[model samples]
Target: MPSSPPNPQLAKRYISYTVDDIARLFGIHRHTVREWIKRGLPVIDKQRPLLVQGADLAEFLRKRRDARKQSCAPGQLFCLRCRVPREPAGWQVVYRPLTATQGTLNGLCGTCSARMCRRVSLAKLTAAAGNLAITTTQAGEHIDECPTPIVNRDFKEG
Candidate 1:
């Protein structure tokens, strides 16, 4: 499945499209475009070649994409597998810092037990974390930046 929905911005609003044209333009199967019509995508009329206005197609795709959006509320992580927002299991979350002020909150989905993560700001960590117990941890430094690397330590200099 596509990570993101097709871009409606690519459609020319002034143009009209046939089922095959829409499938080609959006890189989807012709049947999928036909399904869209049955699923409420408007058409020109009951004519020989079905026609969908570019504006209508774009709007339909935009609305369909918007309908699939799952926004995480406070102390919640969006579970990729479940396609919904879920609170972390056991009310515990790990805060891994990415920068001085920004970090990510990682947790397990209570329902599916799948790993989930959400970006959060240090300043708003409290509000985002809600009642969950937070364990703050630093991200590991780059390997090359280490004072004495294992490979260098094992190799002797002539």
Candidate 2:
């Protein structure tokens, strides 16, 4: 199997690529290119060396790439284990700020109980929260501001 998906941009739209040409371009085996032809990748005609139009190849690859994407709706978080956008359990979410302008909304998946979180800009946090009740968690003080050494800042003696 190929290490990674082939880039659709490598196919020049106007050119026609033979099986071997496409295999070399994508760094996959020539038989794998033939397998792609069998799997609905279009070919010029039923000739000896199969000819695939670059535009068709690019379009096919683009569709494959897009089909694998899972986008969350306004109130949902993507669950890694379930591989779907899911509502948080109990309609509650916790917001922990990572920066002055951005934070993460953390919750448990309604379906699987797997931890789910989404990074959102502070400006858009309300929109991201949608109908869910959200609680904002305060960030820890910076080391210099703390009387004792901060957990993440350093272990230097106060």
TM-score, each model?
A: 0.52, 0.49
Candidate 2 residue spans exceeding 4 A from truth: 1-68, 141-158
Question: Which residue segments of model 1 deviate by more than 4 Å?
Answer: 1-4, 7-23, 27-68, 141-158
- Candidate 2 overall lDDT versus native: 0.74
In candidate 1, list every pair of residues with a backbone clash: none
TM-score of structure candidate 2? 0.49
In model 2, the clashing pairs are: none
**How many collisions per candidate?**
0, 0
Overall lDDT per candidate, in order of appearance: 0.73, 0.74
User: Model 2, range 82-146, lDDT digits (tens) per residue?
Assistant: 64668999988888887899777888899999877777899999988899999888876321121
